[model samples]
Target chain A: MSHFTETEIAYMQEQKLGRLATVDAKGNPHVVPVGFRYNSELDTIDVGGYNMGKSKKFRDAGRHGRAAFVIDDVLLPSQPRGIEIRGRSEAIQQGGKEILQNENVDAEFIRITPTHIISWGIDTHPYHPSSRKISS
Target chain B: MSHFTETEIAYMQEQKLGRLATVDAKGNPHVVPVGFRYNSELDTIDVGGYNMGKSKKFRDAGRHGRAAFVIDDVLLPSQPRGIEIRGRSEAIQQGGKEILQNENVDAEFIRITPTHIISWGIDTHPYHPSSRKISS
Candidate 1:
């Protein structure tokens, strides 16, 4: 079974960019906006960017094994909405092209296996629980 | 002198939202999209949200004193642009109304004093340095 609910999947599909946060060995945090996709087969969030292998975030993910990814945008006139995914991340080489599907893109990527998720303002049911802890 | 350059200040003025990354006591990373503005007087990035004081991010900032804030947007079709600021953070009370100008907003906010900055695609001069470490 997919870790993402249908509404969450739909929200991810509509978004094109997410901010990925990783902590370096020194315990300093870093954040950057990147292209990401929901990998159905792996049930993970895959992030790809230019020169992914050389990026600080990639190294941080490999060293720390923890990451947080957020996709959010404000609706007109002050309504903010988005999702926050916090979980385990793996830095993988030769996997970026599969997610990005661009010939010139790098083959390295960061895959996130979500252990917790918090979302708001995108659900059809207004009173639904907005935060969840995933056991997978 | 301001930590932000003229170009960086201008770019920040054009954007309203930023993603803030903070680390918990357990060394886990958390990120969330936030409403932020460049506080000219304080020379800091001020983040405000609903129930700000009760949010985990607020507590995280209070505990860690370190945070990373990134303001970025894709210029459509594939051009990504943004500025990332990493530095000291303080969770302040009764400051949200000052930055947000909303009476209904909680009186809590996070203030960031940037010690490092990185920017790309937002500068008028292409050959200019894209990253800097501030001594302030």
Candidate 2:
């Protein structure tokens, strides 16, 4: 069974960009916009970038092994909707091509196995968020 | 002089939402989509939301006193442009109404005083990022 609900998966599919947050060695959080995809086979959120191997976020994910990813957008005038995934992250080499599929993409990426999820304005009421924990 | 360049400030003014990343007591990172504005007077990033006082992100900002914020969007075909601000953060009370100007807004908010900044595709070449540190 997939860890994500149908509505969550659909929402992820509709979005092309997300903000990835990783913690540095000093515990300061860093966030940047990146290209991401939902890997149904692994049930993970895979993040890829142009030069992923040398990126600070890639290094941070490798060192800390944890991250938070958010995909959100406004609907029409004022409706805000999105998903937040906090999970175990792994910086993997030679996987960027598979995830991003861009000719200029590097061969490195970050994979997040979600442990907690909070989503709003998709499957539930616009302002009411639904959260759950996935026990590994 | 302002910490943000004119181009950066203009870009911020054009956007109404950003993703805020905050660290918890356990060093776990949490990110959520939020409504934010560039405060010219204090030269800070002020984040406001509905029921802001009780949100986990508000509490996280209070406990960690550090955060990362990102505002990004894709332009037509494929250009991605945005700014990332990492710095000291504070959870403030009785200020949300002034910041958000919404009747439903709570009287609490998070304020970020930027210490580091990274921006791409705004003033510089597309995909080429410029970064700097702000000395207090």
Candidate 3:
């Protein structure tokens, strides 16, 4: 069961930006800002505005066909809640009018269908707000 | 040749944390927070505190090794500089002493060997810092 349901996906769609991470051939990690859209019907997410081989990172994704996306800090540290979506890539043309339709982006689009969805809340004993007094 | 150098790697390692992106089985994108350390000698980076199989997303990494790590919110936006490490993950167990030493964490460690490295920045054409300037 996922902590985030269709309702949660709709809520996150409002905040379109998140941190994206990918690795090049040398095992180094590359991260950047990306704009995303949640397709509630497909239960899928699409990310647009990526340039072709703009960096080795994107090139690696083109070559390897996998990447990770994270959205954090929106939830409190003690009760951090976020989503992780993992998937492969298929490169389409970057000049299409459909790609440019997104008001929040500047590059082409890549759609992701998560095979595994991991969503968790910090339920650690100490950080529970009810367990700790804020003012004191 | 890449723009990121040893000094920048050192600077990034000293920072508290970074965002990491990984792929799920269905080629969906997942992003999360990852605290990592850079190994200068082998030119590799290490990320601990992430568990595979224990969580669905991390388990997805086992099936697909592709990933991206990002650290941002620096002084610059268009030309923001960050280090990206990309590679595979090797699961290993360290002694209790090595695992329990971190001030805030208590768990095993996972080593990620990056195969590629890159330095990323943006063009400043549209990012005019003075655009919002007010006449005093």
Candidate 4:
């Protein structure tokens, strides 16, 4: 099952980049810009990088085992909407696939399986924000 | 002692918004779109909102007490650069001052005091990506 509504998926498809946040061993937060592609069947977002093998964030996720990814757009001065995904993440070198084509990446990936999602705008939900569990 | 270089400050000043990542009590990662103002004197960012006092993110910030804020701009497909701030944070109903001008906000706030910063593409450092303490 897809973890996102079609509306949310379409929005994610349109965005070029998202930011990812993970924690180090001491629980300090770390966030960085990432490019990702959503996999419909597996219900995941695959974030890949060229040097993922040695990246601090990739290592941080190894220890923390959880992450948050966010992407947003400002339709106008006061009209803005975005999505946030809280999920389990693992840095990997294979079983990777492409969703958005980027010439900057190859092979290694951070696989995020959504646990919770919060979204607003884009007509998916009203009253500013909505949250839901991806699954049990 | 400022946490950011002049280049970083300038880059941040040019960006409209950023994403903030915090964790819940259960160590679940949470991220949200946040509009913030960088305080040069205090070397911190004060994030204010209209209903911040009642938002889940605000409550999460209260529980986590730490956060990561990220702002990135992709000049081109391969030229990606941005900033990351790992900091101490607190949600507050008052003592919030404004630095960035926005017609959308008032009242409650979340304050983030940077302990470390990581950056690339903005030329804050000589390396492609650099990490350093807030103070020299």
Model 2: residue B98 alpha-carbon error in angstroms: 0.8
lDDT of 2 at B102: 72
DockQ of each: 0.89, 0.90, 0.31, 0.75
Encode model 1's per-residue lDDT on A8-77: one tens digit a residue: 8988989988999999898889998888999888889999977788889999998899999998877777
Interface RMSD of 4: 1.1
Better of 2 and 4 by DockQ: 2
User: Which regions of candidate 3 deviate over 4 angstroms?
Assistant: A1-7, A19-32, A40-43, A50-68, A74-78, A87-107, A122-136, B1-6, B20-31, B40-43, B50-68, B74-79, B95-107, B122-136
- Per-residue CA lDDT of model 2 for A56-136, tens digit only, reads 999999999899999988898878889999999999998788677676878999999999999989998778889999999
- Where model 4 places Cα greater than 4 Å from the true spot, the runs are A97-106, A125-127, B97-104, B124-127
* Per-model TM-score on C-alpha atoms: 0.94, 0.97, 0.59, 0.89
Model 1 complex DockQ against the native: 0.89
CAPRI class of candidate 2: high
Model 4: clashing residue pairs? none
Query: What digit string (tens of lDDT, one per residue) describes model 1 on residues B1-136?
Result: 6888888899899897899999999998999888788988878999997788999999999789999999987776656678999999999987698788777668999999999998877873222328989995
Error of 4 at B129 (Å): 1.6
For all candidates in order, the CA lDDT equals: 0.87, 0.92, 0.52, 0.78
Give residue B43's lDDT in candidate 3 (0 to 100). Answer: 51
Give the range of the ten consecutive residues with the poorest summed lDDT in model 1 chain A. A120-129
Poorest lDDT segment (10 consecutive residues) of candidate 4 chain A: A95-104
